[model samples]
Target: MTRPAHIAHLADPDDDPFGPEASDRYFNRELSWLAFNRRVLEEACNPAHPLLERLRFLSISGSNLDEFFMVRVAGLKGQQLKEVDRRSADGLTAGQQLGAITEEADALMASQQAVWGDLRNALDEARLHVLRRDEVDAEATEWLETHFREQIFPILTPQALDPAHPFPFIPNKGLSVIFDLVRRSDKEPVRELVMLPVSAARFVRIPGEPARYVTIESILKRFAPLLFPGYEIGGAAAFRVLRDSDMEIDEEAEDLVRYFANAIKRRRRGRVIRLELETGMPEALAAVLKSELGKTDAIITESGNLLGIGDLDTIVDENRPDLKFPPYVPRFPERIREFGGDCFAAIRAKDIIVHHPYESFDVVLEYLKQAAIDPDVIAIKQTLYRAGKQPAVINALIAAAEAGKSVTAVVELRARFDEEQNIYWASALERAGVQVVYGFLEWKTHAKVSMVVRREGGKFRTYCHFGTGNYHPVTARIYTDLSFFTADARIGRDAAQLFNYVTGYVEPVDIAKVSLSPRDLRSDLLALIDTEIANVRAGLPGGVWAKMNSLVDPAIIDKLYEASGAGVEVELIIRGICCLRPGVPGMSENIRVKSVIGRFLEHSRIFAFGNGAALPNDGARVFISSADWMPRNFDRRVEYMLPIENPTVHDQVLDQVMVANLIDTEQSWELEPDGRYVRDEPGDKPFNLHRYFMINPSLSGRGAAIGASDAVPTLSLRRRR
Candidate 1:
């Protein structure tokens, strides 16, 4: 699990000018995010990845770009509509950003199409084919005809476009085919529309072949003439409409549930932001469609591939295991096994940190389930931000409430794209007698902290869990996150206070071990950065290293710039948007930024600062947090940052986890000061962080006897401060 020595060759931060309007001072966050997606697309292009896995990355890139437009680009469009002249911290006006985003998005799509073309050819060779209508064999054509007449025609509804019939409303992310039909009687051409079914499978599996399939759009287009019997079909085009899906909830509403429910309804009819069309669409028809849809800022992108390739997930069959990453079973920590599956008994001995996708998340599920069944457990409190459709955590909470143990769940109703799901869960929880509390209207409860009050030996003892990700079981299998279980009195006390603050609206006091955002986390992070600056002044080899999903807070960026100016070495592993420009001489010469995009998503957050010594020294302070260095995370969301105290857990995170990411060569992308990312060139020894975590057992998760196996990462650098 060791990484090759490569960090020493990267350009040192000491290489620039401190300026307010320097060309290389800051990178545009929007452009930076697009760069991250490009890296994901590169994985799809990489020859080393399995064929289906490459398709998965391409599909993910498509889905990610859709979200970016629906939210980030939509926000920008709104600002431009309102004539707000405000510019981003990177100095681009809203209008300028929209233009830049469109250009980058187009380039990304072009790259995706090229990669997809390669994948399509490879899939053909692998016996799985995405057949165009003309390419379908005679045997398949018979099955497809019957499939369309029986399966599709029954559900198909074609709307005639004329003066009497207004263009029918299309839902968000809906794909449709617009057609020009000529009436045989009048010898006049008429405009018609056929909206694709939303619930239908995106790809229809051909019966003879195992993996061969045809897109729903292709099927619709082939049988479209059957949809119009009275007229001769002239020109037809397949297009997709992307509407603004951002929900706007009123903060002053009396009933939070009702407000959110209504907002979800309104979200369906949101303004159209983008329209995607197939290449070779008629220019006259495109103009007509644009005029009918009254959105002045509607973005139009014409593609040669399928309209919505994100739906390719439907055909990525699980039957072909060899076409994906080799399945790795998650290790249910030996620490829990040592206590015979009793989480409480295991936590009593020592704290444990579980890295997900490699280490199991079932432990978190079992911990909650055990609390629900344990008579000694009296009260349970938890916060859920983005629990998926079949979250086991919600089930455990409901069971506990039904069992009569006092249960309170703070559910964030504004988790974007998950509002409808969260609202339903909130109602279900309330029906089951679990006290459902919608957190602050102005701020989202984004923290992942759960607390249990247990009656241990006639005295109440509290157990707490902190996480860098959500409590969703499905996401746990793919997203790399952290789950920390602790019995420490101070952490438990802090957890209880934080929950009380959210549910009771009481300001917490005497909570010192962990930092909470929207109150003081920003200042605390600044203080850590300042400590690095102070260390450099004291003749110490000061350094700062942080890994998070994004870094966009202007003030925090300024603090890091100052730390860099003071000669403290700084390195950031930002998986997504990064506003700060590293390697800028004079201002940020001592700073570098790199992003990791690969098999497993990098979602965990870790911040380690050299108080007065080099990074990885025993004295260096390390903290794991649910918050990213973003303004919204700090100012508009509830978040938590936990300082790693246990010697084993600390080394496991800083030495093993952070070091693995910092040295990744296969899928790493280093961002230059000029707002471009250069992929790391493979050396003689190629190291992939995802593969490293796959084969290695965690330190704290492994118990005393069998935990010392060769698969466990060796602890050679354990220096405690």
Candidate 2:
């Protein structure tokens, strides 16, 4: 009957329970993200993981931090420069956040370097050696010199740092070695810079029995003499710089593609936000760098070994299968298999949900591939946020156009970091006679939806596919996502309306099944949470469970805190950047938050509400979503939330996917009241959801082979192998 303590304090209202201890109410968004990266880094140090897999984890952490600096940190720095002294939810100002983030990030970078050093030993133990010049044998040195002359020396360009040469421009995330060079006769030291060729391999492989390689930085240091002709090589230190990469585009631009292309060029010249120098560099050389780059000490980082650990991925040997995760073959849904891979017939049987990584994304491609070639199909529509390197999806769309069927693709040119790929896709799609439309400049069409109109018995019918991840084949192998296929008339109509809304700016009204954000998705979410609270107040079983990538929207957190206080159990699985403070006594004690980090990325968004019954109880409410509980998703982007009304689909999402995530103990980390994460211990009985999914198939996809059950089927560590 009364407002929850947290909800009563929007904007930290006076006398609000949430405002009294503002610092205790939520975690700082920037720091929360860094913590997630820490979790990823932990996997690199985890000996349980394969050697190359550990390196992969370390590489991922490095890349994650790089983006954090480029976007989040860069934005915060901009705010600081503009004197925007506003406090985040955790009561930290822009400057304060930067100060704190720098501390955390510095420690994380150190940990990464340490792990890489130890991992190098693990690699050598496995006979995959990463050798330094000193470690290389005389024979290996001769071989290196020969290879250096042929492969590397040809590309070296030395720039003298004198009045005539001035300092050369280094690209963002660019690697270069600073030299204190001296002329033989003058005996005066002259500073110089040698940019590492970006086109060359990061590590030069040495020809040997036990695979060996030397980092390019090491090779540069060893061969600096050869490149510098008469000048003697003095002191050298390798350094790298990371610059602001977040793009700013004019919303009113006539051509989105042209604007993005030009903006990307400007992004390369943005202000430098972070710098890394090898530890123990000459103070004189460091001073020259400081003056040349005009950066403060706050942005400077010292590397223990090699700079840019993310580049470690380049050395991941594909031949060394024993040093990586066992290759997994995704299961093709039996229903589709039985239907001779005809996605339409399988969907016609009933609504189908395919859990990805475990279940192949080929089913999604099957729908598009079939539509492109099928004689009955007359129209194909889809939204692409990130197409990745997969030629299959785009090829299918192009084939549909070549077949003379009407094909439309609403490409979001603003998909961060994928802007270039999308630009190319847009151009290619247009050249193929497909209708290409860039969605509203104000809102990115982040929702992934596809519809195929086919002629059957003189009537046109639409088949739909909704996914929580990109159309990226590479990501599908590592990101755990969902793909739902259905021939249901209501959903198809809703899909058609959505496609129209995105491509044609037609504000959809009277939508039947799906909820769209920036319009009604948030309202629908609030109403669902309210239902759970009301159910609890009415003395019925009530609860709320949501799994998403983030939870930064204050309104959503307030509602969650409301539900938690009203005796509605709340469990959240937010993989990154959760702002809500869970398990805070007197505020959100009933809310429990957990993050899962494992072999696969937890990306699929699923929600469940008791709806006046216990969770997953006979007919509890269930839904799949392409949006997280974040402000950008709710207010600035196009997103979708689809209700799971079909019996089998509901069971599959709630009883299977959601349940497994909740029960996973092996890869889960619990969030505490103080914002610290504690990894769950198996205690002799570990349950790994990833392993479970890899070994087993989804119940809904089993088709007639599974026995019918009255109760929703559940699987747990104890219940299933």
Candidate 3:
């Protein structure tokens, strides 16, 4: 529990003479996140990706923006409304940040529309048409009218917007159409609103050879006469609402489950944060809609053409392999396959690291399944941050529990957007007799670890699995993560202590190998950086390489700045929201930062330090983590950072995984000191890390299958000396 000496000076502006003004030393976290989304949007314009894949990127960008507004922007709006006197790490007030966010988000929304327009045209040219009303032919029109009457009309309820009716509540992200109409009998002007059913598909596919689709709004407009038999339709416009979706848990609530269930219900009706209107909406109509929604302070944008662009993912799901990236089949780790699929046997032989997306996630599942059915396994412990709708992991734990083995599942109910699923899993686990422990109400248990204790030779031996991603199988296929399996007694003991700490609130006194957050993770990381500085001062080669999803903690940024000042070479591969301003002449010239956004998300957390020698050597200190370099991760969540001690596994992670990311050019972006990201250009030799991993087997995964003639080619560092 050693705190860095400079921790006290980090908040003082006058501590470092070489650094810029305290406010100017880092980029705004919110703005940096927007930049990352912009990069995701850029991939939609990248020709290297197949047509459908590019469209998928556009859909992902839209979804990312929605979440950003729901969580990040909603938090700031709350602060602004409460008049709280808090400033961001970069010194922007809540109101100031919102103003800047509005400007940037408006531009981003416009770009998304522009990209969608282009992709729409490309999709049409590829014989996949998203047709306009005018483009619908006679045969398709006849079928669509019939299809709408049968499939969509029954779910529709039109509410007259008159003095007799109060404004109806619009659910979060709900899309609805407002129509100007005239009653045929009295010729009276009237207004009606129809809420689009969330159960209906956003795009209705018309039966045809080319696979044409029409928007549900288009169908509603086309068949307005069918629904309102006595009214003449006039000018109509569509609008979508985005409400505050963040949940606040009542600290004093007697029942935790009841609290979350009520919170989920309340989130749908939370204050409206954004209103997106399709262009050409009459000014009076827009004013009325905004006033009804109580959106005077909400962000209002005239979204062109498409309202909920995230729905474009439906079209991206068309079964046209030609318009998508070639399908890839993941390989099961040879080390486990070599042991006849016995996970414990392979781990007992040696530590193994499985590179996910390239190496199949089935190996992780197999490990759990084996533990569930094995007669020798007497106990199972797991942590669940996000177990998807169809959770095989939960099933395995249930099976073990039903078999009378002691099973403990730490289900975190505050995983944001996945809370409901976690709740369902917790109930199911408890019904199956599994001991379900909801971790600390204040701190989320974000670490991904599973351990099994087996009776062997009249003693218990623990086998552990530590991962940098969720237990969700769907994401495991596309997210680049590491699954480390080990039987080392030190790490096993630490894993048990971690479980004990979360389940029983027993603070670990002397953890041997791994560091836990809300305890000593931050201080330990700072000490590691300080070690590199000491190495440099003693005339030894000093280096550090780290990768994670974000780097927003000010204290950590200051520590890295201190390392850079002491002549330590620091290379960071931060995938998103990096506030650290690298390449600053006197402040951070020795530090370099880059982000990789490509076919697979870079999700693994790794840190390597040169322990008095050059990096990528056997002596370097390498570790894998479940936490990012963010304030909430270090101080507000229960997380773990474990060392890579086995020689082979250490070499595989440091040399292969870390080295490939550092050298990637096609999908990498270098961050400038001024907050802009410049995409790395492939000069002479273009190396794509995703493609390399997809083609080459990882070193540790190859196991005894690796012959002398098939020695894995080594990846070397581009030395900076």
Candidate 4:
């Protein structure tokens, strides 16, 4: 994907700060991800959030770190162990990146503990106490004793760590306690390892008014004598293990389902990537754990009293609405209701976009449900990636197939940790007479698309629902994403071609109205950047505004740098990992980057360009996508980027959605060239994008029901000098 010849001379190798030879131009992707997690940790410290909400953020940070170690660190360790000398985009070798990641991750883990400590105290003040072992009063102890004997002791199994019995296998993310015990009979020392049952709740709540709780580990330690009656308890501490959970697909495997089933089992026993011990673990016990489970180059960290901090989310679920974010109910699209809930009628009139978490995701499900029961509907094609445990979406598909409609589901089994669930979904879908196709062995099908064909008037009209997020109802309530419902023939044809490309291995050729990856998506994006540069050179207005989860693709970043050098004003709202260094003097001085992390996750992907006019205008180009600006998204995934052509939908996405993100100050963080993110200061008029969206109706979703008196507020960008 080379730049156009007309603008090839725009970059001066000798003077370009982001030139190919500049090693320092990009930040390390791993370190940048750690930095993003730090931003999440910072939210735990933000006093503006409700107390339990802050605790929720802290728990999220802990969970994020666990996955990072299980996948990212494990991959690096694999490369290092295999003696592969591959380097990162920023020019660091595998070993070097691992060293840096360890440093950053350790500090991040420490910050998470610190935040947890603060939240724990805050919880106590709010009348929700997480009582320590010593704090358990006589009344509580009597009650807990019965609870332990009845509920927990029955599941207890203690294994001695001796030559006779080898160390027990700890599952990935397993939390256990190593006990130092001396036999009462002979004063003989014995070490026992007690693995915590995954079925048990991490926190056991006492039935009382103040809502008191205690950690299961604490209860076990307090009642160690009950489990080991013949021994006196000595030094004991808790520990947890994080194993390498990443799966490797064998290219030569005969069956994908069987391969993944075995792979999931293997992942449970994969090499331990991290060992976290309590801060006060005895040296003898720590050494035993290290020698046994830390055989590989596993990072060992000494954590606080809490081992699995991610389990704090269980406590956050307590019925304490007073200490959490205010309850929010998403609004169903007014457009869909305008047709008396007829999704086909709304789309047949014109295109519409549903903003999730603000507008309902149930609308997406309703569209499929309607199609399932519609006698005129003849066919349905959907892509499944990260559908949550619920079967709402799955049930709709099965209904459509059972209704005698042609239904095909392209289920991706390589969706990271969601592999097992995807497999189960695929099997269930196939059993329901749905033609389930697992897309390419190498490239994952990550596109979020659903198409339905219905006979209308005299011809078959195809209606497509393209989303920037998954069809999962749970995530839809908290993730900010876009769902575009369209009956436009061009997009409908493109959607059909996309399905064919995935199901039949028929490559899409000269597709109209959309760009698909592993083909020309990257080159197409570059061409768009080139157009912005050319517009500047031709003395017309030039600008670019894009938002995504991450920005790590070197080719795309370099093109943005060239565009910035050519006087195209570039603005990006990347929520997570971003390796590009914005505002470098000679490299991207005209570019600015910010991240928005707030009440809801920013998961939507949007891109807009000034087509010979200033942005937020009718002449601008807008598109929503299922791909982020990352290497995995571009080179190894089946993704799509579709343009927003309908004027009302275009105005809604660009004017309301994109503009609110740009103008948001409460949850924004400005990125510096030095890789530090400074929080955006919300001065006098502190505008919150989330709050704005929650209150106002989206333009396209408002439909004709919105009268002049029900005027939705307008937003405009601050013109650049």
Greater TM-score among 2 and 4 belongs to: 4
Which window of 10 residues has the lowest lDDT sum in candidate 4? 1-10
Least accurate 10 contiguous residues by lDDT in model 1: 1-10
Worst 10 residues of 2 by lDDT: 703-712
lDDT of each: 0.83, 0.85, 0.88, 0.88
Candidates 2 and 3 compared by lDDT, better number: 3
For candidate 3, what is the TM-score?
0.96
Instruction: Tell me how many clashing residue pairs each candidate has.
Output: 7, 0, 0, 0
Q: In candidate 3, how many clashes are counted?
A: 0
Ranking according to lDDT, highest score first: 3, 4, 2, 1
User: Tens-digit lDDT track for model 1 on 600-645?
Assistant: 8899999998777443546778899999999999999999999998
Clashes of 2: 0
TM-scores across all candidates? 0.94, 0.95, 0.96, 0.95
Candidate 2 lDDT tens digits, 143-212 = 8878888888888888889898878888988999999998887888888898988898888887757888
Pairs of colliding residues, candidate 4: none
Report the C-alpha lDDT of model 3 over 18-78, residue by residue, as the tens digit: 2335456767788889999999999999999999999999999999999999899999999
